[model samples]
Target: MTDFSVLAQTAKAWPFELARALEKRVAEQVKAGERTAEAPVIFETGYGPSGLPHIGTFGEVVRTTMVRHAFEVLTAGKYATRLICVSDDMDGMRKVPDTVPNPKSLEQYLQMPLTVVPDPFGTHTSYGAHMNSRLCAFLDQFGFKYEFLSATDCYKSGRFDAMLRRAAEKYQAIMDVMLPTLGEERRATYSPFLPISPSTGRVLYVPMKHVDAAKGEVTFTDEDGRDVTLPVTGGAVKMQWKPDFGMRWAALGVDFEMFGKDHQANAPVYSKIARILGHRPPEQYVYELFLDEKGEKISKTKGNGISVEQWLAYAPDESLALYQFQKPRVAKKLHFDVIPKAVDEYLTFLEKFPKEEPAAQIENPVWHIHSGAPPAADVPVSFALLMNLVAVANPTDTSQLWGFIQRYAPGTTPATHPLLDELAGYAMRYYRDFVLPAKTYRAPTEHERGAMAELSARLKTFDDAPTSDNLQTLTFSVGTDHGFENLRDWFKALYEVLLGQSQGPRFGSFAALYGQSETAALIDEALARG
Candidate 1:
C-alpha cells in the first residue's frame, strides 16, 4: 500500500488541507487528554427538511466525506471517525414550499414543529419525516455512508435533555450573546428557548416571562394568553436557530462541520455560545453557495438550480461528483449546460490517474473522491465525442451508437465497456433534450461553401481508413488554403453547417469516429440544403 501520510502533510488540495487542520486539532485534543477511543472524531453536515434535498445538500456531504477520507489517510487508521447527518425536523414550518403538492394544506400547520405537520405527499408520518426520507433516499442513491440523526428524535427521546437543561441554566448568557444581533423589537420577544405550546402543539416564539435556571423551566404566555410554565427538557422547548446552531455543536462534540456562506455571519455567535456551554465549537468550513444560470443564489423554494436527479439524467453521477470536487469555495453555475464539460473532465482525470506518481495522485480529485481506490476508467471515448456522434448519427438507440463506437475502437462492446455504453445513452438523451431543440442550421457563405466543397472532395479521395492526425492536418491545410485568416472561423463554419451548433468536438477525431466518407456526404447534404 502506498503511504499517503507524507504526501498528505503537504498536499495543497482543499481536502488534504482540511484534513491536516483536523489532524492538528486531534493532536492537540489528545495532548490535552480530551480525546478518547469512545468518542470518535465526528464530521457533521446539517440538512433542513423545509424542501426536498437538492444538489447543494449532495455537495456538502460528498465534500465532507472527501475531507473525512483524507483525515483517515493522514491518521493511518489510528483513530475512529463517524459522519453524522443531522436533520432539523423539530424546526417549525414557516411556509409551504411551492414545489410540494398541496401547498394550501400546509398553511394551517405553519408554526408547528415539522414533525407534527401532515406530510403534503401523504407518504410518511409527518412533513418532516417525508422530507427526511427523501433526503436519506437521495443520499443512499449515491451510496453515502452516514448516520442520520433527527432533531425531533433527539429532543423527544431525551438525547438532548442534558443539553436542553444546560441551555436553560445559561439562558441569560445565551440571550446576551444573541440579543445584540437582533433589532429591538425582536430582541424584546426573543428567548433562547422557544417553548412548544401544550394546547396547540405549535412551537411558540413568545418571550419568556421568567426563566428559573435552578428548576430548568421557563414561564411564558401561550397564544391563548394563558400563562404556562414548561420544563426545557424532554421536547417541551427548543432553542431558536442561532442558539441551536451553537448548542448542537456543543452537545454533539462535533469535531468538524461545514455549511454554506449564508451562515458565515453568525459563526461568532455560534462559537461564543458553544464556549459558554463549556464545549469548544467544531472547526467550521464556509463554502460559497451555488448559483443559477442568472447568477442568483440557488434556492430550494424557487427551484432554479439543476437538481441531483436532473444532472444524473443527462450525465453520470461521477460527473456530478467531479463538479462538486472542483473549486468548491468558488460559486459555480449549476445548470444543464455545465454537464458535458464535467463529464469529459471526469474522464480526463480518471485516464490520468494511473500514470500519475503517488505524490501527484494524492492531489488528483478522483483519488479523494474514490477514497484512493478509483475504479479503472473503461470508457475509451470522451462524452463530448459521444454527444457529437449522437448529433451527426441521430441514432435511435444505444446499439446504433455502439456500432460507430465499435468501428472507432475495434473489439469494444457494451459488456466490455459498460461505462462508455452508459455514456452513449446519456449523450443520446442530452442531444434529444438539450441539443436538438436549440440547433439552427445555416447556409454557408460563398467562400465557406467553396472551402467545404474542397474538403469534401479531398475526404472522398481517402481509400484507406484516415488517422485522426492525418485528417486533422488535412482539415487545417484546407482551412488556411481557403484564405481563412483564423482557423477557428473555419471550424466554426463547419460546426454551424454540419452539426447545427456553435461549438463541437475536435473535427478530426469526430470525423474519424463517424466515417470520413460519411462526413463528406454530410457536407454535400448541407450544401444541397443551402
Candidate 2:
C-alpha cells in the first residue's frame, strides 16, 4: 500500500509534471466557479484523417493517456476525466496519398470534405470514414480508454452549433488572432469560415463578401461566380483548420491537449481564439516530431518511417509504449534498427520497477505505462539475447528457441512464461526478416582463429551447469592468452564468426543460454566453413 499522491507530488517524470499543471488549472477553475468538481477534465488529441493513422498519432494518444493516468493518481479520483480522440474528418482533402490505391480516382474530389470524398479502397462509404475506421481500429488495438469523435459528425449533429454561432458573432475578433500569422496574400483571402458550396459540394475557400452575425450566415462567391448565403450551423459551413483548433477547444472545454512541435508557433493563436470564443484554452504539450532513418520528418503520405503494424510485428506493444514515454520532447529516429533497443529498455525498466523504492517507482516509466501497477518481469532473457539465439539456431519453429530458453532459465516453459514465449516468436520473426538477409560471416584472423579453437575445446571440458560469470571469465582469459591487445577485437571476431553479425549479445550470456556445447559446435562449423 503505497501513497501514490505523495509519490506523484515529488515524481519528476514528465507525465506527473503535466498532471500537476492540469491539477492546478482545474483547481483555479473550480475556485472561480467556472467549473464544478463533477465536471470531467478533458484530455484531447486531434487527428487529420486525410491519410491513414501513423505512429505519430499513436504516440500522441499514448502520451496523453499517460498524463491522464497520472492526473487520476494525483487527484485521488476526486475529479472525473475524459479523453477525446477527435478526427478532423470535415477537412477537405488537398491531395491523394501516395500509399493509397487508385490515386487518379481521388483527383476529381479535391477540396471536397474528406467525409464526402469517395473511398478509393471501396471498403467504406467515404475516404474519411475509411480512414476513421482505421484510426479507431488502431487505437482500439492498444486498449485506450477514450471516446472517438468526428468533426463532421460533431458539426452535423448540432454538437458544435452553439460554437459555430459564437464564431459567427465574433468572426472578426477570431480573424484578428489569425491574420497576423499569415502573409499579406494569405491574409487577404483567408476567412475563419469555409463555406460548403451547395452546387459543387466542395468546401469553398474563396474570400467572404459579407458576414451576418445576427443571422449566423455568410455570403461567399462560389467557383461559378455566384454569390451564395449559407447558415453557419448544421454542417453548412466549417472553420479553417487554425480557427477550428481554437473553436474545438472552446466547445469541448478541453483542459489539456498535446501536439507536435510543428504546432508550437500557432499555439498562442489558438489560445487567443479560444479566449475570444469565451472559453479557456487547454494546457498544451508540444513534443518534437519523430524522424525517419534518413532524419527526415516522418510523413504519412511518404510512408518512410516504421509504422505501428511494422513495429508490433517485430516487438511488443509495451516496447512501443516505452519508446513513446521516453524523452517525448526530443526527436527520435523511428526505424527497424531502433526496435531491439526499445524492447530491451522496456524489459530493463519492468525488471527495475518492483525492486525500486516507491519514490523511484513513480519516476519509472513502466509505472505510468501500466497506470502504476506493472506486471512482474517474467522474461528472464533479453530480446537481444533471444535475437542472437535465433540468429545462431536459425530455428524454423519457436519450440527450438524455447528449448534453449528453458535451459538458461530452468523451469521456464511457454505456458509459465508467456512473455518470454512471445519474445521468442518475435525474435524468430525479426531474425528471419531483418538479421538473416544482411548476415555476412567473415573468416577469423590467425590469432582469432586459434583463440576460438582453444575456447571451443575449453568449453567441452567445462560442466554444463557453469555460471555466466564463470564462462565470461573463461572467454576473457582465452582472448588475452591468445595475445589480443584489444579485447573488443576478440568479441568482434566472435560475433562475425559465430553470429554472422558485426555486433551481438554478450557472448557469455548468449552461450550460457545457447548451451556451451552447442556454442562449441557452432564455432567448429564456422571454422570448418572458413
- What global local distance difference test value does model 1 have? 0.90
- The CA lDDT of each predicted structure is 0.90, 0.92
lDDT (10s digit) by residue, model 1, range 1-530 = 78898788899999988998888888888888887645699999999998888888999999999999999988888789999999999999998878788799889899899999998788899999999999999999988999999999988888888888888898888988898999999988888899999988899899999998889999999988899999998899998998898888888889899989999999999999989898878888999998999999998767798988899999989889989999988999988899999999989999999999999999998897898998898777899989998988988999999888888889999998989989999999999999999999999999999999999999999766686778888899999999999999999999999999999988998888898999999999999999
Give the Å shift of residue 382 in candidate 2. 1.2
TM-score per candidate = 0.98, 0.97
Model 2, range 1-530, lDDT digits (tens) per residue? 88898788878999999999999999999999999999999999999998778888999999999999999999999999999999999998898887789799889899999999998899999999999999999999899999999999999999998989999999889878888888999988999999999998898887889999999999999888889999999999999988899999999899999999999998998899899989999999999998999999988667798999999999999999999999998899989999999999999999999899899999998998898889999778999999998888878999988888888888999989999889999999988899899999989888888999999999999965777778888899999999889998899999998888889888889889988999899999989988
Q: Give per-model CA RMSD.
A: 1.3, 1.5
| Cα RMSD for predicted model 1 | 1.3
